[model samples]
Target chain A: MFWMTWRQHRLTLASLAVVFLGLAGGYLLSGAAMRGSLSLEAVQKCFVGTPLTCPEWAGVISTDRNLRQTLLPVLPALVGVFLGAPLVSRELEQRTFRYAWTQAITPRHWLTSKVLLLGSAVTLLGAVFAAVYRWWFTPATTGAVTLYDWFDVFDQGVLSFPSACLFAFALGVLAGTLTRRVVLGMGSALVGFLAVFLPLAIWVRPNYLPTLRVDADSYYSQSGGWATDFVYLDRDGNEFGMWEALSRAGVTSTTSFGSEQEELLARAGFREMVDYHPGDRFWVFQLIEAGIFVALAAGCVALTFWLVRRRSV
Target chain B: MTETAIAATRLGKRYGQKWALRDCTLRVPAGRVVGLVGPNGAGKSTLMNLLVGLDRPTTGELDLLGERVGPNRALDRVAYIDQEHTLYRNFRVHEVLKAGRLLNPRWHEQDAVDRLHELNIPLTSKVGRLSGGQRAQVAVAAALARRPDLLILDEPVASLDPVARRDLMATLMAAKADRDCTIVLSSHVVSELERLCDHLVVLDHGEVRLAGDIDDLLDGHRLLTGPAATADRAPVGTCRVVHQERAGDQVSLLVRGAPPAADPAWHARRVNLEELVMHYLASAADTTGGGKHPAVLG
Candidate 1:
């Protein structure tokens, strides 16, 4: 069964390997050049004190960053489209499932073998890509890229890529089983990946842990935390909206504020409060998100088996 | 070994509100070449699907080779060839045989390879590129290589040319003779069934209309031509009239179960397999309104 599955998908596997090798090779070549330039004395000095002094090195850094930001997000969707959608839909569309399901091996075993083999391949590919991406972005140690923030692509590139790949693979299998059309399955799987990913990234991830509140004066001093919201507190520590406090201070436009007005407001027992997630919680959030995605993938796989068992060929 | 290869009691299958097969009670004895004859919508495919455990019965029980029909067990001992001869089009001929070897525990690899070679089918060619007759042969070779106890073919030769059909039947006969396995072949072509099968099961209106040894069925049924005045009157003796026709002053009756005592008034002749199947199917259609229109008979 394993050999048959491998033979059946040999072309798909070869294409995926070529694409992976191309991306990895590109990343390695450009990453080495960026590392070589970042090690120069001028670039090192500029990183310590000056801005816009090393235009050549800065151009290389910005270009690499732009490429990573654009391409990393698309990796999971590629896995969903190529590896996951066609697993079952092709058999159904071609009517080869009639031969497949009638073999001496039961349908359950047939599905299990395919899912295990392909799902492992996808996860392993994601892991390799993640490792290479992490290596490529090693310049983050020089304080060039914000690697620890939840919103940064580094989090998605490192931990979330494999998790998202697993989830997308399962989603594709479910969509293929339901639609019984390869193209439609691929489309739905891509849409499903975005639908689940965007909402969680935007709304659910920030609240996975309790937010820390600090005085506005120390917001900038707390450099490793991701600040999300601001509030104003009175003398008794009663919280109020920043807009309400600004309006009460006779400041019509909060964006333009004089230093004297800021001093006055501070002396009047008005303290600004900042809400943020500390940098140390980055791994915690990664684990939480990965867990959620893995659980959803398992659910989709179970549902796929149930659907296969219930429906007639 | 069990005497019966397949035994179904009130087997039925329904798709939403419509029953594709209903109350289909049948018993096919082991080691006989049985022909399942039915028209386009006579539930032939549905019954075959159920027998192969591709679809579950909605109403009753079905056993294949003394074991309950199910995805896990029945498929181990039974091989099925669907009407379309479904195979992976992307696979080469040899790869298909390799798949059969990988999937079936009892797969006979050399037999499949030899059969395809004997037919001059190229092993390196993709199945999608093969002609319809070649694909059908590949399907048969794959099924036979499994060495199953019972082989159920669902209209496998319906689209083949006459020569290809004859070759396929001859191959099937060779396989049956070699392995001594029971075969249930379904087809709408009565003449082909007459040539290929010894036992007959006539299905119409989703029910088994006639079933038994072909010779016994033929011996029991007779075509009687007599005067028109005697047609309305029931035939004497144990024979049950199945169909009646009138032309001018002569009346013809097709009866089942017994041949009446020789009376000089009526001319009685033994019914051939095709005529016996047609009369049974036509009568079944008349009663249930689900088979070929009876007007085709006239």
Candidate 2:
């Protein structure tokens, strides 16, 4: 069964390997150059309150960072489209399942073997890609690059990326089983991955860890955290939006009261608060999101097995 | 020891509101080449699929070689050749044999290899590139290599030319001679079935219209030609009238289960397998309102 799986999918796997190697090579080359620029003495001094050559070094890091960030999300999509969607859909579309399922091995065994072998390969590939990207984009010890803040890259370079790949692969399998058409399955899997991923990344991930409430005066200086909300608290400790508080204070225009109203509000115990998640919770958030995706992947696999067993040829 | 190759009691498969096969009960003894004849949508494929465990029956029970049909022990001893001769088009001829060997514990690799070689089929050719006849042969080789106790082939030669059909039948006969395995082959061509099968099963409208040994069915059914006046009355004997047709003053009757006693007014002749099968199918169609033939019964 292993040999059969390999023989059938060798071309797709080889093509994926080539693309991965190309991406790795590209990252390694640019990464070495970025490290060389960050290691300079002038760059090191400029990172610590000096303005000389800092902008130049920051430019180099941002150039590499921007490209990596844009391409990183596509890796899981590629795995889903290439490996996962066609895993079963191709056989069904071509009527090859009739031959495959009728072998001495049962359909359940055939599906289990394929999913295990191919799913593991997809997970491992995602891990390798993540590891390479992580090593390439490691922050400098003391340089302008050291002050660089990019939470998206950190989240993507850890366990979250590989977990997302697994989820996408399983989603592809489910879509393939349901649709029984390779192109439709691939399209639906890609769409399904995005549908699941975007909601968690945009809405759910920030609250995975407890948010911190700090004075709004210090919010601008707190550069290494994600700010979720800004609200004003009344003397009774009830939170209200800026417009509602202003309306209650009978100030329809914000330009009219200016700083005087601010002092009066502060004296009356109306403090503006900022809700945020600090940067230090990056690993914690990674694990939480990874757990969510892994759970989803398991669900997709379970559903696929149940459907395969129940479906008629 | 059990001598039945296949036994099904009220086996049925339903697709939504329609039944592809229903209430199909049959018992085929071992070591006989049985021909399954049916028209389009007659449930021949459905029955074969059920026998090989490709699809589970929606109702009732089916047993193959004394074991229940399922993914367990039954599959290891029963091989199936689907109507299309489904093989991996990407794999080379030898790779298919290798797959058979890997998938089956009792695979006879040398026999498959030898059979392909003798048929002048190249080992390196992709299955998709082979001619229809060659593809059928490779499929047969793969099935035979498994050394199954019962081989169920659905429309194996439905698409082959006469020459290819002959070659395939020869190959099947050789395999049966070597292994003494029970073979159930389905086809719409009655002449081919007559030449290749000792036992016959006719299906129509998802029901078994006729079934028995070829010789027994032939011996039981007699074609009687007489005046149209006598056609309205049933033949005198233990025989049952299966079908009748009248043209001008002549009437012809197909009788089943017994041959009528000799009468000077009627000329009784033995019905060929094709005529017998056609009559049963026509009668079934008429009974089901699928055709214009009038239903006749004794």
Lowest summed-lDDT stretch of 10 residues in model 1 chain B? B289-298
lDDT of the candidates, in the order given: 0.80, 0.81
What is the C-alpha lDDT profile of model 2 across A1-313, one tens digit per residue?
A: 8999899999988887777667767667766665677665554454344334576556555665576557667578777888888988898898878788777888888888888998888777777777877766554333433554446475455698888888888998888888899999999998988898878778888788779999887876655666778788998889988667777666666757567777766766688899987777777877888899899999998988887777642
Evaluate residue A138 in candidate 2 and report its C-alpha lDDT on the 0 to 100 scale: 55
Best by TM-score: 1
Mark the 10 consecutive residues where model 2 chain B has the least summed lDDT. Answer: B289-298
| Candidate 1 lDDT over residue span B167-241, tens digit each | 999999999889889999999988887777999999886888889999888888889878887666545477778
* Model 1: residue A1 alpha-carbon error in angstroms: 1.6
lDDT tens readout by residue for model 1, A1-313 = 7998799888887777677666777777767775676664444344334237666656656665676667666667777787788888998898778788888988789889988998888777777777786676544433543333434553455567788888888998888888899999999989988898878877888789889998877876645567778888888888877667777666675566567666766776788889988777777777888898899899989999888877542
How well is each residue in B1-298 modelled by candidate 2, as lDDT tens digits? 3599999999998999989998999999998899999888999988887887777889989888898875433387788898889899989998998888887887988888899999999999999999999999999999999988898899988888889989999999989889888999998888887877999999887888888889989988888888888776646477778878776778888887655566777888888889899888877876787755653433
Pick the DockQ winner.
1
Error of 2 at B173 (Å): 1.5
Q: Runs in model 1 with CA error above 4 Å?
A: A40-54, A57-60, A67-70, A141-151, A154-157, A232-270, B290-298
Compare the candidates by lDDT and give the number of the best one.
2
